[model samples]
Target: MSQSKPSFSDKKQITYYSRLTQLGIGEEILITLPELSGLMFTSTRHCRTLLGQMHEYGLIKWEPKVGRNQRSTLTLLYTLAELKAELAQNMITAGDYEKALSLIDNDKALFEKLLVHTSGTQMREGQLHIQLTYDRPFSSLLPHQPQRNSERFLLRQIYSCLTRCNRDGAVSDALAHHWIYDETNLVWKFFLRPGLSFHDGSEINAEVIVSLFKELQTRPPYIKELAHIQSISASGALCIQFELRRPDPGLAGLFADVRYSIQPISQLLSTTKAIGCGVFQIQEHSDEKLKLITNNQYHGYRAFTDSVTIWQVSRSKDYNPGEIEIRTGGLVSNQSSSCSSYLSAGKTNSGLSEQVHNRIEDGCLLGILNHRSHFTDSQLKKIRYLLFSNESLKNKLDQSLDYNIEGVLAYNLLPNWVKLSAITDNDTQLPKKISVALFNHKGLEGCAKAISSILADNGIECDINCYSFDEFYRRAFASTLSEDLLLTSVNFDDNRPTSVYCWLLSDPVLHQSLPQQQRRWLYQELEALSSITTPQNYLTQLEPIATTLVASHLLLPMFHHKQTLHFEGLLQGVKMSPWGWPELRDVWFEQ
Candidate 1:
């Protein structure tokens, strides 16, 4: 009989090959059915099924041990790199680029080629489909539940808020075409466009708006933000009225918030998908990719790009984003043998260029020190010194930031925020060692390892804890912070006072976990600060509070950083949103 070939598509075959490849290729001296089964993630019976297949491929030599506790000798015929490359090639040929990239073992040439094939904007079946890679699988795109900036960006495309804040920080009409506030009577009325509908094609009228807010009456920030409203009701088919106990000038900004994005109540309760009324609708979402198509029925200008496909891929994605040159004035056709077609209305992209553009972002790799239970004041000071005093460590931290956040060293983003003050007494009896907390995200484990190594070198004991976004949000709200330091990146992406206010209000560990008296005082201070209108006035009033935060060493802002993103010249009418993502709504992909 002819020897059978192993199928890469078969999970069992792939697992068997992968495990055999790890058993010291032709050098393995001992093994057993149970031990082998555990390594392959299959039962002993399943392991037996793979024995014949493994032998048939001449990839593994297996000798069975009949008795329990008896050792079996198994030896592989191939190295891991050899097996992975073959499997990765197989996946690549099959057009499973996400899976292919995951299996690649630092094959730079292969990585680039796979990325080139998987990425870039292409015209397909009357739609301009732009493809890009993300580091992980799709998570919640629900209006209020986004855990990261990427998710937030996707949410903006998939959902519509009552109002929207523009690049100039001015509030503009969105779902609500026109709104008026009766400041004297403490009442507000919003008029929705007639014939508006949700993504599901259901009528999205004043009644739907009123019903959604009623459901949100119990959720966070909303409960506090909308508390002044005595009643919210529908005036007619197209009008919503809010009767308030107090005047709320910030209602426009509040409605612009992601928390208030309108979605069907039924889909809001589903875990598998998010539905809304925006310029784009989720056509397909899976572990490999999230596909969004233009909603032509959108009340606003229809999205120029018909589709955007975000491929869930590994960071091994390496390709020159400058591949497509964006030139204006005259049209340029492809000189190569390959035929060129329009990806969008007038955009014509030529191949890769040697030139690249740089974008300096205003963000930071912030280290928020939990000033409560974990560490004493003295210990916190020492920790700060060990973290910030060394220029070498800052370089390493900057590198870590680049890997994790795609950021560069921020020398002076915030003059008052990034404190470099040294500890007065290095020899004074140091306080107890503390734990460091990290978010469970890509490239963050490396940050934890780097931090732990630096502290360990200085004779300091450091424990590391990782939490998912859910755990981080849920625990912090209950005023339970177990770690000494909560290190995360902050973009202040929204770039509005509301953004700052939202940060202060939502970060329970930063505010709510404070001493009862201190928390109350801060709340009152924020309440007063919220009413200030002018920038100078806001800063003048906020300075004292900021000073207290830094001087008291509540949370140490260690490193402020900037991220560099590449945009092709062909991408036209694209501007970075306040949230640090490129606004794709009206982009032409002009080449």
Candidate 2:
């Protein structure tokens, strides 16, 4: 019988595509007949036959862009048909036609190219941008998040411990794993999780625990919560004992303080790194942007996505424009009307909040104020009004003048109080100092009421000098140091209840027992030792110091902060921390 033109089976033709069979040229960037002949063993005559067969089957078409005009030849441009023919022809010259076919069949790179060509190259690049604002100039890793909830909301994967509070706002560990109460209810025993490690690769043991408390003592005075701690001794790697001289219902709440709880003391001490056992690790950080990568080593569940970035920006309805630029050692949060105007107009998406942008502008001008110079009536009234409304104005006061307004009813100092519970029940009145203190300058709601309630219940005079953040800090520093006063409220961002720092006035016995001298000293120390450079450790160190100083008051047992979040994907066993974020281990990606 005569051979039927050496035809290949339909199965073989389909297999070329289905099994990722490589087509076209290899070894030669620019495929020519010579290169193809070297690959295909069949003779040029057989190559011509294969090309005719492929052309008739419409396997490929000619490309004018890559083809050279061959006026003498019928084929103006070589198609895949010619390419395959050339491959076979080259194999024939080598005396191994079957081997050449086998080589194409096993070539992965060729297969990928075929797939890419067939799919038409569907690869693409994606990018994301975020906006953020900070009260202070965006310092390096100095943790100064407004609230634990805000921090947690922004950074989704940090470990946290939450406490359940009683109706009286007392931190109750009754349902906790191990609960014990002593005479004054001043001592607490906590069982630590086993196998916890710091980001610096240090084992979390009693020594680290002791060092943590010690570090807190040396930190800024604002964090005086841990001050009441006479000692913190870990019984084992997993157990610890905290001894206090007096009762404090707020102890459990202190754990919610973001400044107090992030781990890796060494990382906090290092200017280059601020380490935490969160779901994400810092991939890159600048004053205007923060980028994080998933931390595979996290004991908590994984984050919903692989990476996130935050951009530092300011937004405002006003004409102020802000400046964001990289400075030596860190990025500078500079705000000016010119920059704010651009950002607000939506012409420049710098990603800053209006409050933050304005604060920078206000701070820049306030920083240059000279109280010593003679002031015009308008200037003096403005200064007096600002100072009278917010104690922070004291920072701008002339150093030569002693016209200090102490214990004066600067104003009614009344704040509209709101209960944190589902329903307002057994509500306590609030004072002005705490009310003004809690005002969220970034248009944060409920701060005034929250602080007012806490102060009202504490039986202390209600008072505060409500000012912008930078102005508040500058003036508060002056007042806190020279005025011999300590401002106390539910620890900000610690997820502690306002009642923990408030509500002590009702308990006369507890208030009388507290040592005023110690409290004064603690306050002075915080104001004296405060520094913007090390704001993270400074904030972290405040908890223990504050606790130690106020322990005798037996105030709010544990501060309580509540967080509620919304998610679209499967998130399993999510636990909310004081920082207002979810624990990674507690959260699982269902999809």
Candidate 3:
């Protein structure tokens, strides 16, 4: 074979082209203004002169030399493709790299443009600016659907849920007091608080509650813990009874979950009424924006602002409040870092200032495994191994992480939440701890903090690694992923109290993915654990782990951060709940 002549190593080679399709740059040729129209600006002849001047300055290069004698007027042709590349190279090589980088990285124009166009959905002439970063098309914008609630944004403004958190950052006692278990957790009785009502002017009563439970039994979505119920009887005006086959101790905490609480049955019937008993009432709503008015009849603390608006934003640019009018989303607890600074100086470089006026709603994040996958067996085993072998994981899991080692929870929610027979493990069988992974950076920080605090209080010791939400999702959903879990927030409408709990404690009455027997077993385990009291005793059991892990400073607790809105000017005179709402009755806006 003729040895490939040494590839020309030193010669500089160049390729010239009329257009750079990849970069969207094209060479410029001057012809009377006619050609310029198609090549540069079709509406204006001004572009021709602009290109001419650019070539003169050597900012762009001309193709053929200018001639002296020409019929029409001869001018030099320039290559925008070559000019841009040269400019890009100069930016990389120059010491002032930031200037060049800025050309690519700057988003100021984009954001300002979006700000002008967020309201664009209805306008044809003017740009409506709505800013967003990511899109989850599969998500259900409505609460009763199978998808997660819409991702946080200003749109959270118009809606209000039944449960509101307290100043101590705990779900309000009123919400927690709903479920109370008698001697045997199996005979569970819940009392609907009096004076509670939905926005439809309907008082929440036993009948509405019975209808809600029936709905859960018929159309369970996220409700998992209520599966163990053999039957639920609404005892007239006040009490509801849950009869189970066997005694369970963990039932109380399961009821305490805000996601399992009741909503107004009538309001859920129509999207129009905005009939929630919570702090705010819907004034106006569209896919793009929502306006909420404070409920003067709200039974809880008065809202702090006169009105709250949720405006849909565009995804084209990063946000700076100056580019758009500031709006609030779900409020974060004082567990956030900026809360202290805000309380002291009234300002800080954090999202807290914006979210301060928002409110807290009940939610739970859970992990759902893809049991049908080929690697399901290995993943399940791996999760079991990790949860049992890793002391730290198990310790954090007791309170925030709820699972049944027996595997009673359904693989998915399909048809509804209904009672399934209890599963029994052999006497020799040991409970398996579940191995789970969560985002170290996002809401997981709060989960980790809660677990760590419990560990510290109980004198257990452990170490934890920090991770981003993206990484967590990747690992949790990976194919080779054996033994991985994801944290999902369970947000329930008040009208759907027992739905989530039923799902947690029953086999798939709907999806029927996992064997009914296996699901029943899982439900039974969950029900037993759900009956167990966790708030006080949970930390004590972790003492052994705390002594070893925390003593070494391995596991650390970090507080959760949430966003809200605040007003400074004469706007201070506006009266509403922590999250803004136009509380029209007893409250009014001064400005």
Better of 2 and 3 by lDDT: 3
After superposing candidate 3 on the true structure, give the runs of residues whose Cα lies further than 4 Å from its correct spot: 1-143, 146-172, 175-180, 184-186, 248-252, 256-258, 266-274, 318-371, 376-524, 535-591
Residue 244, candidate 1: C-alpha displacement in angstroms:
3.3
TM values, all candidates = 0.71, 0.40, 0.41
lDDT of 1: 0.61
Candidate 3's TM-score: 0.41
> Can you tell me which runs of candidate 2 are displaced by over 4 Å?
1-138, 144-179, 313-475, 478-591
Poorly placed runs, candidate 1 (over 4 Å): 1-116, 317-359, 374-376, 389-392, 398-428, 443-446, 532-547, 589-591
Task: Please give, for residues 257-327, the per-residue lDDT of candidate 3 as tens digits.
Answer: 33334565543455553445555566656664555556666656655534444444443222211122332
lDDT of 3 at 448: 46
For model 1, residues 539-562, the per-residue Cα lDDT tens digits are 345546655665555555544433
Candidate 2 worst ten-residue window by lDDT: 359-368
Candidate 1: TM-score?
Answer: 0.71
* Candidate 2 similarity to native, TM-score: 0.40
